[model samples]
Target: MDVLAVEVLRIPMAVDLAAIVIGALTGGLLAAREGFAVSGVLLLAVSGGLGGGLIRDVLLDVPVVALTNPVYLPTVGITAMVTFFFSGWLSRTTGLLVGLDALTLGFFTVIGAQKAQLAGLPVTSVVFIGVATAVGGAVIRDVLLAQRADIVQPGPYNAVAALIGASLLAVLAGPLELPLLPVAAVVIALTAGLRLVSVLRGWSAPVAID
Candidate 1:
């Protein structure tokens, strides 16, 4: 492994584990709202939680973490359990679920950029991969559920937040040589903050009505 690769590997696996939990929670909440059974919740949880990482690894030409890491499976499993236990409370709040989804998007976007940089991909490629990583899972979830994806529709700055977060990661990686955790933190905070603010302020990209 190269220096960047080694550095990236040194990043605590717990971060990705945490993201998996968050993704599962979001997925479970969505499934419950959609009147899915326990099996459906598990399916969505696994799909949503690991989907981004799987896509990222494939794009980077590496083994998918879902296949290689035992940690990934249990994390989603635990998340499903928690969601199952707390389904009553979580199912009542759609906004909270949306917030978690936005957070997942931010974290995954940063992770994608970091991985791409570690793989020595170009900055532009890293950005594209980051956006895909952030939104890919939700796209899959939506397609599976047969609903319009939030990233594709006008809801908030979902994709924009991912793009900005990825751009920040790419710029920071190139110059500051920041550690993965700090870089991820900054990117996630910025992206999630922008998303929350957009939600609160009704900020959105203007579309020209043809």
Candidate 2:
């Protein structure tokens, strides 16, 4: 593992674990809706849970955390299995899905920015990597399902929320010398707030007319 990978491994386990479970649940539910079998559901869940971090790690030229960490892949598998078995009960809770998605978005976005900053990437690269980490799994899931990538298409401020948080973190923690934990908390709150509000308000980027 590279230095960057080692740094990522030291991140707070709570944040990483929460994000993984939420991401896995989101993917598993989508797979169930798509009528996938157990294997396909597990596949999608793991992809969704780990895909963003893996992409970010690759971009940073670091070892993939999920691949190297025994805990991560197992967490993904267990979350997927639980989501699969309880999907019927979970299906009724749209609010739960929305909340989990927003939480996962926040956690991943902040972690990505933190990791990229530690890797000594430029501010622009850090922000981009943060957004990529926030949505990479969903992008992979959409591609696998042959659907339009929500992050790229017109959507409810998904990547925009990530951009807001990542840019703020890059500014606050990079030059302002703010403490990391407080910055992370604020970033997560902002990202989750933006996402949830956008969903509730039906906010979207302006459409282009040719």
Candidate 3:
């Protein structure tokens, strides 16, 4: 591969790993809350860590890197172990889980959009792909835990935040001629910031009245 292609691939991997670590931490905490065993915690961690990327790759018709590469598994595994052992500390660290989860949402959103752009998908499709990647893991996690998916739930504008961020990045990168790195930074910041504000301010979509 050429230098630019290699760089693109390398950058995604960094964002993917960051998302994985944060997702694993959140999954570990959830498993602990449910009184899950070590094995269960690890399983949940892997699901949350790699699930969204798997969905994104599948949608893009690309090889799932988590399956093909050794690094992803080990990185998530170590993160899960640390999270499992330090559950108490993590729990005590107020806002840590929420912050990490929001950041992960942003990372996945950007990853999905960039991949779709590289695939030469249309702008609308890129936005949808970004939203899908952002929410796929949470949907899986919710199913496993027997809880409502965040995207469907009535609070905090989880997927909406991702959509806004992803759409913003798509516009900036596609039309405004911004570099991918700066585009990604703005997307992550906006996505995470929106989520944080929503949570703190109790923002939610309007409910249908009977």
Using TM-score, give the best candidate's number: 2
What would the per-residue lDDT of candidate 1 be over residues 35-93, giving only the tens digit for each residue? 89999888888878988878888878887868877678888888887887788887787
After superposing candidate 1 on the true structure, give the runs of residues whose Cα lies further than 4 Å from its correct spot.
1-5, 92-100, 175-182, 208-210
The residue-level lDDT of candidate 1 at 191 comes to 92
Candidate 2 residue lDDT tens string, 8-114: 66557887898898898889988988889999899899878999999999998987888988899999999888878888888889798898899889999988998
lDDT of each: 0.81, 0.89, 0.83
lDDT ranking from best candidate downward: 2, 3, 1
The estimated TM-scores of all candidates read: 0.87, 0.93, 0.90
lDDT of 1 at 22: 83
Model 2 gets an lDDT of: 0.89
The per-prediction tally of clashing pairs is: 0, 0, 0
Those runs of model 3 whose alpha carbons end farther than 4 Å from true positions after fitting are 1-7, 10-15, 208-210
At residue 126, candidate 2 shows an lDDT of 86
Report the backbone clash tally of model 2: 0
The whole-model C-alpha lDDT of candidate 1 against the native structure comes to: 0.81
